[model samples]
Target: MQLTPTLLAEATRRGLLSTEQGQALWDFLAEQEREQQHDTPSFKAAHILYYLGGLIAIGAMTLFMTIGWEQFGGTGLLLISLVYGTAALLLTEYLFERKHLALPAGLTAVLAVVMVPLAVYGAQHAIGLWSDGDARHTAYRDFHYYIDWRWLVMEFATLAAGAVALWRYRLPFLVLPVAVTLWYMSMDLTPLLLGGDNLGFFSDLGKLISLWFGVAMTLLAFWVDLRSRHTKDFAFWLYIFGVLTFWGALSSMDSGSEWGKLAYCAINLLMIAIGAALSRRVFAVFGGLGIAGYLGHLSYTVFKDSLMFPLALTAIGLAVVAIGIYWQRHEAAIGRSLRRILPAPMRELVEQRRG
Candidate 1:
């Protein structure tokens, strides 16, 4: 009838008791079970103090932020508070690395809140609301435009920094979102450059550079995940979705005649095929989009000119036949080449699946 070690361990894991407290409780219960005594207290006060301390700490920090100490030092107090909060959050993370405390998430949230007020204040100081007579009005306008350029630069810098930081911190989860954000910003700037608005062709060039960087970042993310022993998680799926959406949108925006469109479509298809061959999830997602897009185009073509439908069908049939013949002749050589290029583990997987 004595309490078992397994029960004691389960209680600790469930947080009903700390390990030390659980051990003591188990010993007491075992003694009582042996002696037929039932006088011992069933609960301990230590657990209550542990939770109470956490609640007090949270409440104290909340009160400190809510109380208006701004009158004493104005902006200085706010800045000091921000710095102190950031430092404390970082320190807590460093001290409690094993707890999964989500300190990074909290720090990001707090920084965002601090930035909101700073952004509004800077905007107001730069430009008066709806008043042209204010000298600051012109200055604000300039500031606004300046901000656009500043943002472009900052976004690029952030993209690079995020890549390096991801590698340094070994947090592949962050790289894709940051890359996507930078890509989005670059896309927004693309129209301005295309319209000859004088952000310069350099801006267009920068956008193209960002586009390629985004592609590289995405591939790197996949490669890292594939090589990693960790389970594929939310971040991996997010990158796949983002890459597909971004690339699909880009393909739709491409302007060209039938031949040009055909070429673009072929390139997209090749990209997908390569992705599938590599077994990269992001590539597979994009490949699916390419397939959908191709089918949609074929449907549009057939509906627009029913007579062309037969010719299109014949062309597709011939293409498929030709590809099948080529694959039959070259599949072995291609497989060997791929195995040489891939890592040892991945190469073995590829070899095992060769058709």
Candidate 2:
């Protein structure tokens, strides 16, 4: 009757067993496990039914999206998907105790994807992607002249809805959509400060503000993770890295001198290195992106006038890979250390099994 330290911690977290109830729960669970070694016919039948129901539900949703929903208006489709997804999630939570089913997350992610494309199409339509008469007679021309505040209101409403959903579900997948909405909002406000005539300044300011906000959010997420110890949500760290890299790219683009370029490259490399040293997965993934970017810069330089092999790229790649491997090994050691720190009840369970 062995209880792993991880299992004990999980039990404590779930309030399944208090300090006094730990030993009794362990004994009961062990006995239950022993008695359940031989599965009953009904148990097997129930499992089969559960899986079959999940499959059928997924298939039906897929068919509805492809056949019935695609023909609807963009707004209508989004609303339908939202309602159906919410209903499905509620039903699953009520029927089964599975709180974190993938279907709802999948549905929301798909809806976000659909929103982006539809929003882009709507923008194109308003901007006169296809206008037969005078260019001034196009939808784009009319849209700007008669710019409705309702469009801005709708965007803000959508952003608020997304924020609420993310907060309710605690899903990290919602971060991108939330960030996108924030960026759009920032862009909408840029004209107020930078002036509509200074398009370049407005664009630059918008990007800078968005990147700064992203960095701020990333730092906040890390702070939350530190308090909670939920390293599984690695996406927040990745988002931070992405925003920093983008900021670096923008800085490099604006740099005019050779030394300025070199400084930008050095700063970007330093940030990536620091980030990689902190997280092995991020290091492994973003190290590749950093290498590709450096190589592209090197290629551009070579084509312009300078002909030189990029030894720095090779060295940087090797360094990143080496650090990633070290972190992986270090993480394993940490796991072993944690196992040795098991509480008394869990340690007792382990001893019982050994006896």
Candidate 3:
């Protein structure tokens, strides 16, 4: 995708363009890169270290938290969280708004928003309010391991903080924490919505809810992608969370009928096709896993006693490899034909992604 000097030279040598035209194209691309370098951030050591240090701090205080952190008492924890969040916000203002350091600034903003859960948890503890029953003495680390409807408090607070940060800073990376909180919220809400029943955590009812919510989130991500084409990419994390949630739910189904299992395989194949058309490889990755799961079922169940199964599977694998090679050689032509079949609006979206 990068236009390099050697690539220009090769194009000229192949008579694809004259030397002057090739040079002009290279210079134009280089100029665009230079103008965008600040927003995009370079892959240099200093930038890498900057982001790494920020992420370590963020992760230590959030995901890597231990029960000992709660020993400071609720008020102390609340004060500490507030102090850390304020410092991050100030740094974000300086680095992102004033210095135009988009990547690091966005990470700092994320860190600030991620502190909201700690603050909320501390406040709840201070107020003597426990979301779950008889969990007044529950360890803080258990919040992550156990899914309780009570954790909805922290999830909602985190989501709110993330949304405010994004609205104020217009940073695409801030969407990650928001999306994560939303996913957690979906899981935690399962008990509340379908409670008083025997359906446990990650049961079929919860999976169905997660699947439908994931579908909604995926559609929302597509909408954001369309709108943010000229700005920083905001839909990437949404798409990631959506795909993970949807695929996790789909893969966990325990259907007993052969037609149902085959239907699952068909849906996974459809996902792969859609992913290819949209150029989003996440769908392909999940779809491939689903297909593999189905194949595994066949090997372990339907074809368990048959010697021909292994040979047939090997032949299928070889055929797939051949198809991949052929597609790699003719990708450009295939892309053109695919575009022709797409509706006008979808064609425009695909062209934008190509750019």
Candidate 4:
């Protein structure tokens, strides 16, 4: 099926075409392949630089923002963010609509999305909606480091702006800000929902809320995945952050009894199975860590005095490795069988990815 130069030469040898024609066809196909690679996302030098530069810019604006910028005050930060966002959006329009560059356009759109929170923070402060007296609410930089109920306004604004940008640009990378904001909202909403002057931010109730929010986000990702599979991997970021939120909150909760810990292990095992079934590695990675942590706990406690523990652990590790080898060898058949066992709609979901 692959039209390679070797195959073309063989055809010419068999008198199917002249040497000139074979060379012409090969050159044409090579050019076509190159064009396709250029059009799509890849690990090429240009593409790598595009993303790397964009990430650094984004980090500088958000995560790496300095305390000195706090001197700008709310209104100043607001105006600066709007100006930067406008420039980024104008550039995005030029790149996508004029220059026809998708990667850089997406990156610029993401930059615009990142400005939403800063603008919102400024508006809140300038209008006296957010009090400057609160330390957590004093500066925009704390937005990345602290979780306060007051951040809800900025978080909601970011989500809205992110949604609008994604809808306008139709870029997969635009999902990043939305997913991250949702994750922050999950934590920030805790104190607000539980009710207090920020009393239950790290309470047991907050943890449960996080777990539930993660479940919702994961389900949303699944829905997005099923819909976007034919177009782009728009659901990828959502699945990543969703799993992170869920797994982190789940792992943080105390399981006082051995039975409780065993139940936790079982839940993680289910996550791994679900991940494998869906071909999404995010679930598998977190699940694997959880299982490893449980096993480590047992080794340190239940098997501490047993000399055979090390041998048992080694055997288990080797068995897992063997299973992986066997799975890789029979991947096609196994994948087909797994898909077959699912309900019709679920099978369709997996089949779309596999196909």
Choose the strongest candidate by TM-score: 4
**Candidate with better TM-score, 3 vs 4:** 4
lDDT string, candidate 1, 252-299, tens digits? 444457776676677677767766675555666676676667667877
Better of 2 and 4 by lDDT: 4
Clash count for candidate 3 is 0
Task: Report lDDT per candidate.
Answer: 0.50, 0.49, 0.84, 0.87
Task: Give per-residue CA lDDT, model 2, range 162-264, as digits (tens).
Answer: 6665555554545555554444444445555555534322356656654565466556554544433432342453355555535543553555776765666
What candidate 4 gets wrong by more than 4 Å, as runs, is: 1-36, 39-42, 199-201
The reply for model 1, stretches above 4 Å from the true place, is 1-96, 100-147, 153-169, 184-249, 253-255, 307-355
In candidate 3, list every pair of residues with a backbone clash.
none
Instruction: Give the per-residue Cα lDDT of candidate 1 at 258.
Output: 70
- Superposing all C-alpha atoms, what RMSD in Å does each candidate have to the true structure? 14.3, 11.2, 4.0, 3.4
User: What is candidate 3's lDDT per residue for 187-255, written digit by digit as tens?
Assistant: 878888887333534788989989888898889888888787767789888999998988888878777
Clashing residue pair totals per candidate (backbone < 3 A): 0, 0, 0, 0
Off by over 4 Å in 3: 1-28, 35-51, 131-133, 136-138, 197-200, 325-330, 341-343
Models ranked on TM-score:
4, 3, 2, 1
Q: After superposing candidate 2 on the true structure, give the runs of residues whose Cα lies further than 4 Å from its correct spot.
A: 1-152, 186-188, 197-202, 230-252, 280-288, 299-355
Number of clashing residue pairs, candidate 4: 0
The collision pairs in model 1 are none
Residue range with the least summed lDDT across 10 consecutive positions in model 4: 194-203
- lDDT computed for candidate 3: 0.84
